[model samples]
Target: MRELYVKSLPLQDVIANLAEAFETTYFISCHEYRINVPEGYGSGFIRGINFSSGFGLIEYSCTFKESIKIHFSVNKIHPLKFIYCSEGIIKHRFEEKDSLHLIDQFQNVVVASTAQNGHILLFPSGQKIHMNSLEIARKDFKTKIDCDLHYVDKNLRKLFRDLNARNLFYYHGNYSLAMSECIDEIKNNTLLGFTRRLFLEGKANEILSLQINDFEDDQKAEPKRQILRKVEMTQIQKAAQILKSELANPLTIKDLATRVGTNPTKLQEGFRFTFGATVNNYLNKLRLEYARDQLMIGDLNISEIATNIGINNKSYFSRLFKSTYHLNPKDFSKQISKNVLLEKL
Candidate 1:
């Protein structure tokens, strides 16, 4: 198994060279540019085949300005590809015949061989692939397996999706500095070499364990269902919306209950029942979200934004922000600047 690193080559040239080197009937190109590969590859024409270290290979590419096209043959073995868009939008067409998958900034598209006709092509701003077979083989020979891969397979995809979605939503929607740090760690540090493979194998089993525990608890739990009437549900939703929209204003449970035509106690209970948290907790979340947006966009001072979000005490606001996000306002602000610098690099 070899690690191939190619940079600054024109997309067409890379594809032509790769096809010939691999001696395959066709080569699939997954990139952000339009590339044409000539037939009957010869000298300097790309062709070669190398055993991949893992079941698949991970490749990273970036494009500035022009869009690129990738070509892949129908019969080639396809490895699952995880495309992460850091900056620009990428449009991908699986085969010559399918509708293109449009991936926007900060979003990811996962392509599996199971879905494609034995081949997958991607057009991405940047991506990382985890070749499963190569990785499994390498690990299988070197170490004794302790976990069940089959169990992990059942839940890994869903867990990854959930983790990705949560990170994406927080990243895009704006959250406090603490949340941002967690997101960064999850993005950059969560999956590496051995750890990533272990996660890929054990995540599903871990999730299953949790689910079983939850089910056991549920079985032992008293079954008192709080059945909300339609009107009650509508009022709870309205209250949540109001809280979200008016985070800067002073709000009380009584005020929220009055707005929803319910008593404060019932309103509190209904909100907890519907959202799984107290109304005050929900409001704090909204406030933190608002603060996060201000921090990410760099438009307002932390104190001013905090004040506007009804946090009159500056010290208290900072503490709350730190508690919620793991980073205080200033550090979070600085971290955002750092991310911008990394992006530019």
Candidate 2:
């Protein structure tokens, strides 16, 4: 993955000279906090690319003052922008249509243009706006309708609202704090690189699914059919409990399925649907938890600990331990011991 930062103002001159630049519009400025982008140009209006991978491109803009108008005209590229307002408000006029008024500390808007004619407006200062542009190729987009709709679908919007409501308890309704934590982790934590991105994408999809469910519920539509059978559910529960009890053992999905009297496919699907994680994922989590307890309480060498946890592959076990804890096993053990000594002091 590569990241690019571009902020050259006197953007008025850039806008005048660069006819090929793309212009996108956003009504809500608060959505900027949700984007992952590089920081540039302290106070003035700034534009830069945050991250670009095989997944897509994310561009950002942080503006302090509002000019009369700002224009970005690009080639034939369709990208989605998530805008966040840090301070004031912005009225957005799109395709010269009636202006859409949005105000608040934060908001998220997704925009895509097919042919031409796309524009946006920014209001007075005291507020800032951030933008993330995700580029989806037309060919790949057709193959992944579910992935595409995950961002702009109405159902996903409701899901975000619901999750935001829950997050209010965490951040006292300050969306910026919640968003900053996500972005900070994205920037600082190497372990979170791919998984964090995947998680964000999954959250977007879940939001979309929730919106669809809500719409169906509102119209009195029948619920989506579930694929899990009673037998499957029972087997999944059994396998999970067994895995929980035996975290030290080498566990395979096939072996778990056999023990639970089900096939591997059913076992995998049932565990995921019922527990929100695959069997191996759940098992690894369980092992990590047990390993933590052992590290804190037991006097054991790393190899001995790994053996006791049923991880006979010591090197693989060490890697998993470090990935889970962000510290090598010996270091983690030493840190725990240090904490214990401090408490005694």
For candidate 2, the per-residue lDDT at 221 reads 23
TM-score of model 2 (CA atoms) = 0.34
Look at candidate 1 and tell me the lDDT of residue 266: 57
- TM, every model: 0.35, 0.34
**Cα lDDT of model 2 by residue, 174-194, tens digit:** 122234334333334343445
For the record, the alpha-carbon RMSD of candidate 1 to the native fold, in angstroms, is 16.7
Q: Model 1, range 89-205, lDDT digits (tens) per residue?
A: 555554434666665544444444332232223433223221111111222222332343333433333322331222111011111122222223333544545555454334323
Off by over 4 Å in 1: 1-230
lDDT of every model, 2 decimals? 0.47, 0.48
Task: Give lDDT: candidate 1, residue 160.
Answer: 29
lDDT of 2 at 95: 39
Could you list the CA RMSD of all candidates, in the order they appear? Answer: 16.7, 16.3
